[model samples]
Target: MKKTTLATLSLAMLGATGAAHAQNSVTLYGIVDTGLTFIHNDGGNGNSYSMSSGNMSGNRFGLKGTEDLGGGLKTIFVLENGFNSTNGKLGQGSRMFGRQAYIGLTGDTWGTVTAGRQYDPLVDLVQPVQGDNWLGGIFSTPGDIDNADNSARVNNSIKYTSPVWAGFQFEGMYSLGGVAGATGSGQSYAGAASYSFGQMNLAAGYYHLSNGNTLAARLAGTTTWDSLFNTSVNAAYQSASSINNARIGGNYTFGPVTAGGYYSYAEYTADGRSLFTRAQKYNTGSVYAMWQVSAPLQAEAGYTYMHSTGNSSAKYNQFALAADYLLSKRTDVYAQVAYALASGTEDPAGGQAQAVIGSATGDSGSNKQALVTVGIRHKF
Candidate 1:
């Protein structure tokens, strides 16, 4: 009798543990995107072809989980890592969980709050209604001056997302510099809101960041600023001490077609240690149309215009077209082409502006540039 009772107790304990485990859920997800790319006039070397990674979307693997805590509240966490599929190397400066890492709690009646490395509010809200949602960075601003490509991610951030109410939602974020004695130095903040009514959607946001007072703090290789001006389009303003960006966008869907446009203004503030003494301002406008040709096929066409003043007077015009075909629910193939033309003197070299299709290709070394890519993407 004693032996039988002990076995029964063990079985009951195992059953209780299993029931508790069932209340928690975890998921592993990843995407692999690779492509063959061709660029005309790449860094003055005419006609270059190479295998590229992340033409459509960055390659990444992530784990997300939620634990039910009763009372309609849950604890959530996510760890995402980015990599280069072509070279089999880590991306986002080789951090283990470079893309995102956050933990927080959510409730039915209240909003969600998370803390850790994260994308700013503008990228979380406004980018969804922009052309880059379908065609990737090739459809973004010339150099992604306003972070349309999500080139910059904030570290040590605390974010709040409001639950949707009456088809409207909002998000706000602030990143801590972690500097002792200086609370505002190297800080970043953003706020954004979006509304959806029927087939129409609208979004707007603002972002600001301080690069610290020292020259070394604003340089590219550091953790404080991590400049996104890798391309020639805005490299001349890399020494800026602060950056401010404001953007607005909206889109409408009618039957199988969707159309949208966006405008952004970005300003780079200069200081005594900067390369340029005057503040640089950039204005960008873009419009796009996407067509769902069939259940499995889609096409998009977009145009962008960017003008810069203050440091130099320049203009950039870019045209892009792309098509994607879904082979399965989790697999797709795509082709994209873009051409860019630049005018006026924007180069610190005192020469005419060089066209760069997007952040993907190198400087054209001239006034015109073009890019073409055919890629495959798979999600698991």
Candidate 2:
């Protein structure tokens, strides 16, 4: 009897220890991707080898943990950082947590609320339909002009996501400026909603920002670039201070083929009336189709058109095509090429202009621009 009692006691202690460990959990995850990219333009022509992070998805290392608090409630946290896979350096201007960092709580009925630098609802709801996300980063539109998926993250944000109902859900976010006495300065806000049913999905979103006077000041201070390009900077800065953007996008899948398009519009108002007083408007439209030719081979193509009006009127049209072959479930080889042309005074200066202001290289916009990229990506 004594021996049996001792064994039972030891077993009970082991069970208690296991329970303690289960209450707290942590996980590590990341991805690594690299490729070669080549660009041809009027300013200069060269073939360069480069490695980039987040080609298909941003390369990142992260730690996530959860502590069960009982009664369907849990405390969770995530700290993620982006890095270049080729050179192993920090991304997003060297910010340590450039990708994401947030802490939050989850409840079964109430949904989740998270704080810190996190993606806005627009990115969550709309980016999936963008070719940029589908084709990787190389051939994406300039600066993801649409901000379709909130390609640009807002700082000091608090976000709330709702539980799904009938395959529909919504989210909202507010980025606190964190600047005292200036309640609206440097702050950004966004909201978005999405619905998914079977193979069809749809989303719409809006974003607004305020108090970007500093950006304008910096542009005015710089004289290295000419007026044409300088004005572009001024226009962009002014728009940031008082800007609005809206988008609607959706995709439908039929067997191995999917087709979709998105429309986006943006308006920027200057801080004070000047040449920049008139609200600058940017409208963009894009459509794309993709098909899986074989079990491991796929092809995709897309086109995007943009028109900027207000301080100046510039027209841009771009076309892109890409192909990919899966080496394995987690690895793929791909190639993509894109061409862009501009009309009006904003045109590339033939081969004489090296970079276009808004173009990838910041050279003159007098000539056509092209980019070809071939790369390999692996996910983990």
Candidate 3:
């Protein structure tokens, strides 16, 4: 009798544990996108070839969890990591969980609110309307000057999103300065909204960030701007006191083909300690079209134009083409080509600017640049 009672009690305890486990769940997901690429101009030298990662969607793995609370609300969390698949290097400044790391609560009616290092509203809302949305960085802005390629992220942030109502959705984000004496220094804010009607979609967004006086000027343990201008095109603006960008984009679908376009304006303002006296500004515009050739194949083409003023006067014209085949639901093979031509003049013989396509670590020897990449991508 004693043995039977013990067995029954153990079974009841196991049943209660199972019930608690069922109320909460966690999932693992990731994508691996890698490819071999060829560039006509490598750091202004000759042609070169190498293996690349994150050719389409960035290579990443993440865990997402949710605990159901009563009344249509749940606590959710996500921890994501990004890496280079070629040699296995961590991305986003070599930080662990660099792609995304956040925890939040969700409501069926109130939408989601998350706090952590995260992408701004523009990257989340406005980027999906362009060819790069489907073709990847091959169609990205020349030099990614306006972050059309999502080159930067905000740290120490709080974000709020609203549910779609009447085909419209919106979101906002703010990052703290984390400085003791300065409340506004090293702070950033962004907002975006999107609308969809029928087969057409439109989006607009703006982002603003102010840098601390100096990385060390603020405090011993405080957040500072990471400075996103690592490219050859806009490196000079890294010392600016503030940066702002405004963008608008729209897309329309017709049967198996889709057409889209966008415009962006960005300004980098300086103070007494900056390299230049005035604010530097850039204007970028692009248009693209995609054709679904078949159930498993697609082709896309895009054109981009960029102009700069203030500290320098330069212009860039770029074009890209891509074709992709779906090998399976979670795997695909793709080929793409991109080229850029730069012209104009800047004092001190800034020389005719050289073309630097997408995130390629090379610059054209002359006014023209070209690159070709063949890649495979898998997701799980």
Best by lDDT, which number?
A: 1
Q: Each model's RMSD to truth, in Å? A: 6.4, 8.0, 6.6
Q: Give lDDT tens digits, candidate 1, residues 307-351.
A: 998878899999999999999888899999999999997855666
Give candidate 1 regions above 4 Å deviation.
Answer: 1-22, 220-226, 347-349
Off by over 4 Å in 2: 1-22, 42-54, 213-240, 273-275, 345-366
Ranking by TM-score: 1, 3, 2
Q: In terms of TM-score, how similar is model 3 to the real structure?
A: 0.91
Is candidate 1 or 2 superior in TM-score? 1
By lDDT, the better pick of 2 and 3 is 3
On the 0 to 100 scale, the lDDT of residue 211 in model 1 is 75
TM-score of each: 0.93, 0.82, 0.91
- Which candidate, 1 or 3, would have the higher lDDT against the true structure? 1
Which model, 2 or 3, shows the larger TM-score?
Answer: 3
CA lDDT of each candidate?
0.85, 0.65, 0.80
